[model samples]
Target: MIRLPDSSGRLRAYTPVGKGGHGAGAQGPAPRSRTVFAAAHVVADPLADTTPEGPAAVDWDATLAFRRHLWAHGLGVAEAMDTAQRGMGLDWEGAAELIRRSAAEARAVGGRIACGAGTDHLPATGQPAAGHTLAAITAAYGEQLHTVEETGAQAILMASRALAATARGPEDYEQVYGALLAQAERPVILHWLGPMFDPALAGYWGSQDLDTATDTFLRVVAAHPGRVDGVKVSLLDAGREVALRRRLPEGVRCYTGDDFHYPELIEGDAQGHSDALLGVFDPLAPLAAQAVRQLDAGGAGGFRATLDPTVPLARHLFQEPTRYYKTGVVLLAWLAGHQEHFTMVGGLQSARSLPHLARAYELADGIGLFPDPELAQARMKQLLAVHGVH
Candidate 1:
């Protein structure tokens, strides 16, 4: 290979004509014609790292930069959610700061953005001595909701682990959510995160049995249809999400967070399709936006063609022990050149093994996710070297 110096004096490897980024160079229009929101994540700051048992040290510059990238692609940014590592490494204080910053940034560029509002600041079992169980959770959620609303961004009422630990049955869910929704400044998006994302939320609606949970969740929405603008279901259960969406009252959008099975869910069956607000989308934003734009063009074949190749890659990243999926997410971002490094809060880059990462890279490359294959390959080499592999 011949190395040529460019204007920047950086060595550029000369390869066979038409063998570089020249092919599938830029993101093309998405094939499927539809509107699917991509929940975006922060680009970790290279300078900051997460303490094992503490809040994350976010790189504000890189963090917001990634959101800007999402807006540039005509996708809405869903911040302060699990995608951003909320409740994982992002504490309420950090989350509030993030919501404010991202919301302001979104305003500057006129970007469509929504953020998560949950009772994460409070303890699971109950609030402090002064804070009542219901009131504490309510107040914590209200604080985040107010923060999000103050920023002029929409609100996503993310499920609460605090509530999960306290609630006795379906009625508790109804009372908590019903009252909260009734007093909302505007209609808010409701979120039902399954155990997959946070196991503590298992049987979230009321019972360990899924059927009971579904009934309870739908009933709450039905009782207060107007206050609920939409529901984000992250169970990774395609059939259940679809079934629940089908029963949703008119005007209530079902934003699917089923990362493992989103392509088909977004595709929709005979009944109707789901709009998206998935975490997998944080890293896959550009590609996802391009795909959705294709669907918007009424290209069912094109949508599948573009996204189908990506499923295996997504599945590999979100494989069992799914909570650590963030590692894969950050890894791909580094490979794709979105982030400066492959490190994450809690040093989660080591969460997955080298073999797991090797497979992820292979799948992502085969699907043409990297705009610059050479960059990706170089980054892969760097990651391997760090692992003490020559």
Candidate 2:
């Protein structure tokens, strides 16, 4: 039995369900029903002399190995996304390296891969000089876009904090995105990451009102047809996403980023279902792949049965202050033995409190996410003891 601390500072005894729950070794052909991509996380080099404000020190071997694990489970790897700490600890240079390396690895393993491209090279804050200008933002995005395209991977146009900070109104957004869309070498996935994921993006698409903002968003897409493969909606509003999915132009897919309601969203009604590009999938890849395979076999009920139980863990990992969700993600990765240390780019491992992490461990353990529950339990104990929980 392991003792886990609750929010109330009380310890609760829990026994791990151990191995043979939901095996992580399950692998198969990619799901034909939905195009799913797990936004993967980067492993930090724990021994590096790194600081919270410094450029990320990535563990290239372990990081690439984790991507291979995701690919082995028949999941597309969404590399260098927010889940990889872009705009947080990872700078533009690091992200470029990651995109190139992971894309090459994906080709070697015959795995599907898409990479995020944004103006993260520019300082997020609006500068008095070139950084604040729409042209500068566009140029920054172009540079990153070129990098991803050269790697022969699909480019995901990630929501930009720089654009959010600099755009004067919807027209500015339209102009900037319009320019980028026109120059694309291939159809790209547009990401609408809600402010909940990053507070700097509160008034994205030129309006604080979601209705108005979504209007601007659609106009941009409507202006550039066929250039967009899909829009990855991370608004966390299932109803809004459904509405948006219905409104998208023919051939434009809606990849759901809603961690909370994915089971139902993916298992849609008569209208249609959203494809997935979710951060939660990083840790849930094995079971998620199995569930999608079930969907492919026309067993929606089985898909729900397999995936519904995982919602609690997803909700917990992506709780309020949602951007810090990466912490719990890397934690689970460590517990599952994907990495030797529970460290993250930018030292984000300490973002969540001890109680919060404890709960995440309990929830994930309950779902049998770990390949070896004993290793997980031992890790959890070591973490707790470090915090003086014993």
Candidate 3:
């Protein structure tokens, strides 16, 4: 039994439903119709001095083991992505190493893997001439793209903070992407991360009006049909994402990064559905695998029945200040025993409040995510006590 805090500031006693309580139905083969990848997180070296402005020091063993865990459950790994804290705390040097190591690990186990390639290496404050900025951003991307291809992994052209800061209009985006896409060793996934995730990207696609932006985005894809594989939309607006999905040129997939409404998007409508490259999938792996298995077995009803119950938990973890949702992710990972401590790169564990985390814990427990409820309860109590909770 565990006592947890609710919204009204009272502790509620809860019992363990335990893992396997959901039954997960029998795990079938991976989903055939959809390509699912879980944008993974890194385990911080708890002993490192991970200050707000300092460099990140990660636990290589734990980090790689988590990827193996995802692959073991039949999900591809989306490495060094936002879920891995790319712009937040992880530097380009760290991300490059992670890509090489994770890509190598995936090869050893026959796991599908894609790594984020972006222009995060550029200093955020440096203001250069427009041409200089575009050239530098392109060079930065080229460097990371080279690293990813050299490591034998697919590349995801992540939305660039530098480009977002520098670009004057859609033509600049097209010029930069067109050049990079032409040089790709294979078709790569493009990313359109919304301003909600990174405010620096407020006017993506050269317009605040998403429809206009979508048009410009499509124009880029139109110019390079064979060079693009798909686009990962993390806008959190389902209607817009669906709209974009319907418009993508044939053969280009829309990988849903909408954490709040993934089941419906992936299950999709009659015309087509989005594939997935989601951050929520990191914490929801076992359940997601089971749900995808159900879909693979042609039991859409079973798939919905399995996944719908977990939405409240997902919604809570992904609540406002959505970027900080990474805190809840690492917290759940700790309570569920994925890592020994809740510490994060750059001390991001402190990003969320105690109450926010308490709610996340309660919600996860409600869904039977913790393999051992007793252990989860104990960890929760330990965390609360640290914050002076009686």
Candidate 4:
């Protein structure tokens, strides 16, 4: 429960509902001995648009602080990846600079870091000029890949909206990936993002049909066994991801990006489990890191106990009109005191509804996502006041 003075300075109590009062064994996340990766997003400055190059604003201090928080929890940071609003509002130039900045920060702190390499600069909506071809796309990937490598960061080969727009079939996916993999300095994680996150990737990996796309995607991984380190599956389809994980090359990893169903996906079945690479983790770092440590103790039941409760809040934050999910994410950051204000790049904080955000606050408070739930509730009420919803 929370007690705070209202606009009129009258104190009132607000009770926060939790998951029936259970912890440490009610089906939370299990600890993983394997290295866990989180494709973290950059927290934006609330007061101004910092992206002089484009619409996105990058809150340098808060963003780096969040990364430090993840590192403190022992999770590897995958910077400049999709979770950082890449292609949404964060432009390619901004992404490259972010990778460079974060790489330096990671090095300064002895943290693990990886950066995304994609063809977002190739234009997601406009027609390619007359002579454009996959070669151009390949070159684009090469440029970004080299930049990441030069920064001394591992590479996450993200899916291309441009490729999805122009591919003829699975063959296209194979050809593009094969070329990129052949030249990589080290084994890289290939990313397969579903359209749910960004509709522009509707038929990513060549075919619109998921099964065919998976087949084509895995074939690339299979063909380049040594060069591809692992695959980041963001299809939000746990079953398919599991099936695909079973088929990966011996040394490769299956990094899950399914925020909708991560606890179960990472928990794995008899076959195997996925390593983490989620945007949700950016906000749930401490809790996720703690749960994974429990799993490492042969206590999955306990791990899930810690994570399951947060699912409702995660689901709510990532609610449909899905891409706009960033809004709720930033809101929680502000309320949790990770950032000083509630603003977002491209003004994305205004994306969700009052009731929607209201429920997010309620659910978050319920799960104890905040260290000081009272402060969170007070901030939430202030947010409600801005929209005249209180």
Q: List where candidate 3 sits over 4 angstroms from the true fold.
A: 8-10, 19-29, 126-132
Clash total of candidate 3 = 0
Compared with the true structure, what per-residue lDDT tens digits does model 1 show for residues 323-375?
87888888887877877888777567788877787767766776667767888
Candidate 1 has its poorest 10 consecutive residues by lDDT at 16-25
Model 2 C-alpha lDDT versus the unseen true structure: 0.92
- All candidates' TM-scores? 0.89, 0.98, 0.95, 0.90
User: Which candidate leads in TM-score?
Assistant: 2
Candidate 4: regions farther than 4 A off: 1-14, 17-32, 49-53, 124-131
The regions of model 2 sitting more than 4 angstroms off are 19-23, 124-131
For each candidate, what is the lDDT? Answer: 0.78, 0.92, 0.87, 0.79
Model 4 Cα RMSD, 1 decimal: 4.7
Model 3 lDDT tens row, 140-205: 899899999899999999998788778888998998999999989999999999988888788988
**What digit string (tens of lDDT, one per residue) describes model 2 on residues 319-367?**
9999999999999999998999998888889899999999999888888
lDDT of model 1 at residue 36? 59
Off by over 4 Å in 1: 1-33, 124-132
Candidate number with greatest lDDT: 2
